[model samples]
Target: MASFGWKRKIGEKVSKATSQQFEAEAADDKDLADDDEANWVHATKRRKEILLEDCVKKSKELKDEGANLAENKRYREAIHKWDEALQLTPEDATLYEMKSQVLMSLHEMFPAVHAAEMAVQRNPRSWDAWQTLGRAQLGLGEIALVGKQTRV
Candidate 1:
């Protein structure tokens, strides 16, 4: 898991303040407190959610920029922008799928295949990711066959 230091601190502060307020409100009622395990899980989830929102916001901006670049046929520049987005949201399967498509267009068979594999691993149910992987594999096979034919 990626270290989200600031996100965790902010989340903890919010949770602590909220908990204290709730405690004060319930002081006279004597309500039972949540167990340690539940508190820990809730804190962890809140921290993760905050970090995910931040990354998603940043990554979406970069992905949109990459899409515009790709529309202009600037494949390499688009790939660079997508690469930046991936650093922010490494598990975004769409980024991986799109990056592999650009790599395939650039005839980077191995890297295309690798990116597609990452997409598949990130989201096994994503048909777009599977499609990109299939295209890369097919392209690589075709290239190998052509090479063999020339050698013979």
Candidate 2:
């Protein structure tokens, strides 16, 4: 019974040692893999660029339709079309600017300000966005001063 107990203990130690050694080798392989030059984040960025390109065409079509509606002074329908275009490409600064224009036509100064702000945030380099934001701010200020007798 004593000899049998010793054999079982030795078998467990051997199995544990083997497992540890295998795990150590696997870790070493992972360390080597960490040095690989094929950085995957750039690949992901490229894929995102491709997806953005695909969205561009459809979003532009919706935007053009919205523009025609806006030209006809159909502001509400234009807003709906703009909303769908934005859903297709939410990152588009131009869309936000257009929506801000429609909101201004509706005299919804607060919402126009919000939309213009979104356009600026999406593309700070866009002069149109900055201009729209400035206009919205002016409109809001005018409403507060003249309509509401407010300070802000």
- lDDT, model 1: 0.86
Please provide, for model 1 over 13-124, each residue's C-alpha lDDT reduced to its tens digit, 9 standing for 90 to 100.
5687798887798974453355556778999999999998999999999999999999899999999999999999888999999999999989999999999989989998
Clashing pairs in 1: none
Please list the C-alpha lDDT of all candidates, in the order they appear: 0.86, 0.85
lDDT of 2 by residue, 31-147 (tens): 767754345666778899998888888899999999999999999999999999999889989999999989999999999999998998999888888778777878877544333
- Runs of candidate 1 exceeding 4 Å displacement: 1-51, 142-152
What is residue 144's positional error in candidate 1, in angstroms?
Answer: 12
Residue 140 CA displacement from its true place in model 1, Å: 0.8
Pairs of residues at least 3 apart in sequence or in different chains that clash in candidate 2: none
TM-score of each: 0.61, 0.59
